[model samples]
Target chain A: MSDHQPSQKELPEAPSTAPTPAGISRRGFLKGAGITAAGTALLEGVQGFSREAVASTPKGVKEFGPEPFPVTLHINGKEHALQIEPRTTLADALRIQLNMTGTKVSCDRGVCSSCTVLLDRMPVNSCMTLAIDAVGHHVTTIEGISTDEQMHPLQAAFVRHDAMQCGFCTPGMVMSCVSLLEKNPHPTEADVRYAVSGNLCRCGTYPKVFAATLDAASQLARKA
Target chain B: MNSFTLADCSTVEAALSQLKDGAIVKAGGVDLLDRMKNGTDTPTRLVNIRNISTLRGIHSTPQGLTIGALTTLAEVADDPTIRTQYTLLADACGHAATPHIRNMATLGGNLLQQLQCWYYRSAEFQCLRKGKELCFAFSGLNQYHAIMDYGGCPSVAPSSGAVALLALDASVELTSAAKGKRIVTIRDFYLQPDANPHRFHVMAADELLTAIHIPKPAPGTRSAYQKYGEKESHDWAIADAGILLEMDSNLCRRAVVAMGAASPVVRRSHEAEAALTGKPITHETARAAGQASMTGAMPLSMNAYKVQLFPVAIYRTILLAAGQMDRDPSAAG
Candidate 1:
């Protein structure tokens, strides 16, 4: 896939919304409208979950809606009190709200680890973490790491090994590496490969990335 | 950063007192946000419950391991205690999504992640689960649908972690508005389509899955879990296998063989378990046990391949846990 965002010229024209095998009837339309209205209203208001409500509403309908919920998210050692929607993902919270854009948001889905971030000294896909759900969690984004003057050891190691190509994946890759070395200071080659199986590099920089992970681990191991 | 309201409750009673018809529990939000984004799941009130620290961490003792349902996949995977005892579950977490997803996705969230059915996800397709007349996945992309557990609604449960958890004899602690807190087995966590296809979990509307209690493995039991997908790694399992075996003087004293991505719940093989117990672990016995595991399977036209692949998984899992896959070269090689 191209690194460039989808340009309007590159985008396809809107397709016609034709009725398929089973078209929506008036009653069906009303029902769909009712559901949309209910969900939108809940997202707009962001209130009202009780045990009784849980008991009343059936499963499979996904009764959760968007709401302005207060959360105290700890990034690095700093605590941030922010109002977020129930549906707002930690990835969006970092990229959009906190303005920490180092953690890329290529795959909005949780499949790719482009949005990997540390939570309580472990790495996870920020895109999949619900901000409301992450209340009281210790979230460490790429920005939360490294001092103003000194770069983190992992970052320095990546630079030393020339591990990056386009550098789009550096932040998340380094974060995942940091998590791996933290748990296993001296990982075998297979261990390092398996640890980062979740992340992808479009430039196919696995060899260099693997070397950087090893180099960083060695450097950190010596310091420790 | 977007806006939303909060309804915090220590008990189900406080939440239900204010909740009428449209409230939803907000646990870790991994699945909740997807529902919100797709316009498929929405509740008038979003109940926040992660603050209840009591509902976190794994409780491991001689009898069993009691894991909070809200426990993160990373916690379940990395717990030195769990990695030592319940290696099956630890492997499941290590295999789920990627490192990042494992961090945010909770055991509860993984178990309750929305079905991967394309029809249900698309706003246009009104599948049977969503109150529609027919399910296009039946005729369309039926490759991933259930085989044995299909007679009723044909959706597959999306929990790879739950499968290993159940194989370890885990149970859940559910908090209800009316009934208070209660415990049930991980096997009881699911509801089959033959009973109610609309939902997968058996918990009541007012009930919340607060914790899970997993019994420790028997003295000599060793367990292993392997999830096979199209990709060698970093992908959802198209087929998954879990095995727990207790060895007594070179003879298999007890065995539990479970498979997921096969049904709405992890399918345990009683016949396979029976064949292995009180018998010496051998290549022939392992192969026979594998055959008996999927004996009564009725696969869909597309997913029938599972029936074939399932047996190999059964055999391999048995030999692997028995420490025979690497040691013995008698076809269990």
Candidate 2:
């Protein structure tokens, strides 16, 4: 392979114990250079802090994988037993492994709230959460919000208000609002906006989303 | 993300033990997941410390408040005591990122988050923070880069939580199986870019931040935080200010002023704090303090507007802490 990048010798030292896999990712290459800089940077003042940290002796501690692990996740009140890679995210577990495609994965980096889900009723980015991390928590997705074939109040209001244009951000937006309404049943316009602030709708349906959520709040209030 | 084995640690000791052998700690996994996805950090083993129940919660003591490292930003933001007493911290936590991120982002993790510089985050640009030779922000689009104490890298401190904690005079506790535990003031926790551009804070890779200790405020002390972004919501601060004032009626007996996103690390403006202390917080005094806050600022090619924005942010934050300002200063800016 003809490499245009600088030679490995020109790069900075890698962190002493950070294992370099056979395939050096772009970041890995840069990280090697960074560790070398850190070594020189810490030499003067932070030597005591950095060296001791890097020199810690490895004990017989439990470890799990550069491979797959069996994990049980509680999703929508049901237990799922599956073999998943340690690196697999909760969003992938739901969408790919279990075939629950309602949850979207727009920004895999958690910038957009397209993959928002409820973990123990608190809203979190499903793509940012590890599958094993959701083992004991209750995972709720857009599909699980509906009760017995009846649309959730928020979902019904979203449809009535035409809150979605392309509907890509709907699941995450709905999930974020669902959490808010569950806690604050009578949320104001500002509250609704704040609740869905994490959700990005490039389709420009924010005004409609606010209207749908406020309308759903009143509907839930009427039933109560 | 590179594959790794996940070890669900039930105890801090267990987590610390697993911290060795090319393993990394996972708190809220907000920042860690970003690095993993970017391929910047590829740990073969992940020490899942989220399950350590002992490492979660906020405890109030007669001396002050001791918050566990695992306490999420949402928990801190919603705590009634924190809201009523440490309103600066509450505002910083509440207004950070968004509701979803706040729920998963822990106070400790927020304090130690890596720089938000585009050149650093993107793998394509090997900025100095990532161990490369040059900071692209020096010659590239740096509208959001630091203006004060940037040193070698122009990356700004990304944590609003650290800004509040610095003004509140908080300290963090870091524990390692090898070295036990040590407490360092929040101001000292962060390292300037010149010291080590590669590391954001002083917590060694093996050390785990265990707790944040905040002393009880003296009577008559009030505080507030103001963050200004180009977009009103869900954006990093263009200039954020946290002000703490010990007031006797209208007179400011003492002051602590901290500014974030203006420098490589969250910095306390001794000049600004000196300007406010022993003076009544009025339009003149607040304006003077704001000016003092920017005494040594050096703006980059595309970020001179921040130099103007920060003074306004500091001015309003001081007034807000003293109950003289009603509307958000950020809104005006």
Report residue B191 deviation for candidate 1 (angstroms).
Answer: 1.8
Candidate 2's TM-score reads: 0.87
Worst 10 residues of 1 chain B by lDDT: B324-333
Off by over 4 Å in 2: A1-62, B327-333
**In terms of lDDT, which candidate is strongest?**
2
User: Ten consecutive residues with minimal summed lDDT in candidate 1 chain A?
Assistant: A1-10
lDDT of 2 by residue, A1-224 (tens): 12233233322232445545766755456546754753453343232222233243344334454345576777776676776666678997876666566799998988789999999999999999988788778999987888545889899999999999999999999999999999999999988888888898999899999999999999989999
* Model 1 lDDT tens row, B55-146: 78877666777788778887898899888778878878877876666666788778777787767876778777776668676677878777
* Strongest candidate by TM-score: 2
What proportion of true contacts does candidate 2 retain?
A: 0.64
Which regions of candidate 1 deviate over 4 angstroms? A1-83, A132-138, A147-150, A222-224, B1-4, B9-20, B326-333
**Native-to-model Cα distance after best TM-score fit, residue B291 in candidate 2, in Å:** 1.8
